[model samples]
Every structure is written in structure tokens, then in C-alpha cells.
Target: MSKKGPRLGEPASLVRMRVVPIASVMFASALPLMLPMIANSPALPPLGLLFFLCWQLLRSEMWPVWIGLPLGLWDDMFSGMPFGTAAGLWTLASIAIDYSSQRIYWRGFFHDWAIAAFLVAIIQSLAALIAHPHAPMGRVLGLIVPQIVISALLVPLFMRLTGKFDNFRLKRR
Candidate 1:
């Protein structure tokens, strides 16, 4: 091993474990916003939130309850939502997912996907409402329906990606 630790190409230091996951989550959280999109749409979906949930569902206790605060704050910086929106919602989602994990014994792929879909719907719906407070709930939902559908559909893909990242993170030098 190198003096500091593993070499550049070697596996990450999972003995600590926090660094890898935190870094990945932060990057994914900002990624969608980083891209220079000529036209942005509601259907773009919250890939960041999906990624975060995928990690939590994959490893139920990997993060502490407060994990969401800093990461969601990071997301808030890029998300352009009235700051703290992501912080509050992600923190809440983290708690709900944790509670569900405890209540449900079996967490199969489909089951997790369904759960993820529901959370995405709730999050997007709430965000839409926040963005358009005076508008009718129906109108807000209409605007965010595509986003919910797209995010919910991509849950499996995000899970798969999370698995890959987890594997890489856990590998030893």
C-alpha cells in the first residue's frame, strides 16, 4: 500500500466507508443541475434523490438520520428550490425509508421500486406545490406527473447503479 493508503487506481478506503458514499451522493445530487441543458423539463426527474434513496434501500443502515441534512443542503445549493426544500424533504424521506425498512422484512427489487416510486411522487408533488403555492393542487400535480413517472420508472436503474458504486466502494486494495 502507498504511504497515504491505496494507490490512485486501487479501491477506495471503505474501512471508513463514509467518504465514498458521501462523495457519490453529493456528486449525483449536483450532476443534473451541472449539465448545460438548452431546455429543462419537469420530466428530467430527480435523479439525485433517486440515487440517494437507492443507496439507503441498498444498505438500510449505511447512513445516520442526520446524513440527509448536509447532502440535501448541497442539493439545495444547486436545485434552485427555495433553499432547505431538499434538506427538509430528503431528511423526511430518509426517516420514512428507515421506518419502512424496519416494518418490512423482505425488500425485494420490485418492492423497493414500488416504495421508491411512492416517495418520488410525494417529493415531486410537494415540491410542485411549493413552487406554485397559489395554484390548484391539480395543476401542480399535472405539471409534476411526468417527473414522478420518470423518476419512479428509473428506480431500478438507480438501484443497479448504486449497487455498482457500493461494490466499488467496498472493494479492498
Candidate 2:
């Protein structure tokens, strides 16, 4: 007798369904930082960027370089930052990742984490500079250290969550 359950192939209607969750998750990750409590916190990590980078590194093929522009624009709108801040930074990051993937022949968890930390530091520093051009260097430097450290610390968790999302995306019905 034939099986009475879902067939072991791709779902016909999954095209739209798959895209929604990914974009939704990225948007959702940004929401927490917007809250007054976290927004005002001295060390609120950029969770949105964290998740985006984690997803990019985890599923390198899923996001082409051009995708960063729209995603960054989306982030800029919701983040209340300047128009091109996140857009430029995210686009740069994607291009950098693309270049690195082509240049580097070896990769591992440690390498990925180190790369993430460096990127988070650069992005956070630029974000701080863009957001507060008049602020003193010392003050901005102080705030940025904690933010970058916290964000980098969360890389493993982000990686785990991304792995779960990957499993969900690829699972057969």
C-alpha cells in the first residue's frame, strides 16, 4: 500500500512560505533593541546585525551581495538610524564576506567566530560614529566596547538558532 502521509518531496507552496520566515526572523531580531529598556541600556548588542551575520555565514549561498542593500534599508527604517548607515555597512559586510570566501581556503568554528568579532567591532564602531558624529571619541569608544563584546559573545547562540532555521528550511514534509 502507498504511504498515507506527506510525500517525501518539496512542497508546492513553499516558495513564499520559506522567504517570509527568513525576513520575519531578521525583522523580529531587531525589535528587542528598539524597546525603551534595551535601547537605553548601556550595552545592548546589535541583535539584528548578529542574526544577519550568523545567517550569512551559516548559509553563505542563501544571500547574494545585492540582498544586503534592501535588508540594510529595512534595518535603517526600523532602527531610526540615518538612511544609508546600515545599508552601506551591510552591503560592505556582504561584499567582504564574498571576497573572503573566495580567498580563504580553510574555515572552522574558531575562524568564523573571530571573523564575526572583527566584523561586529568594525560595524559597531562605524555605526557609533555615524550616529553621533559630534560625540567625544572617548564616550563613543566606551559605549562601543561593551556593545561589540556582547554581540560577539552571542555569536554561538546565533549560530545555533541559524542552524535550527536551516534545518526547518530544508526539512521535507
**Highest TM-score scorer:** 1
The list of candidate 1 runs beyond 4 A from truth reads 1-12
- Each prediction's RMSD to truth: 3.9, 2.5
Give the lDDT of residue 172 in candidate 2: 59
CA lDDT for candidate 2 = 0.76
Q: Over the stretch 1-173, how does candidate 1's per-residue lDDT look in tens digits?
A: 44865566775575646677788888887887777685544647787788888888899888987777888899888777888888899899999999998899987899999988998888878877786789988777877887788888889889988898888777766
**Candidate 2 C-alpha lDDT tens digits along 53-163:** 877777677777876787777778767679878889988988888788788877788878887888989988998889999999999988779878888998998788878
lDDT for 46 in candidate 1 is: 81
Model 2 residue runs over 4 Å out of place are 1-6, 9-13, 16-21, 33-42
Least well predicted 10-residue stretch by lDDT in candidate 1: 34-43
lDDT scores in order: 0.82, 0.76
Question: How does candidate 1 fare on TM-score?
Answer: 0.87
My TM-score estimates for the predictions, one after another, are 0.87, 0.86
| Top lDDT model | 1
Q: Roughly what TM-score does model 2 have, to 2 decimal places? A: 0.86
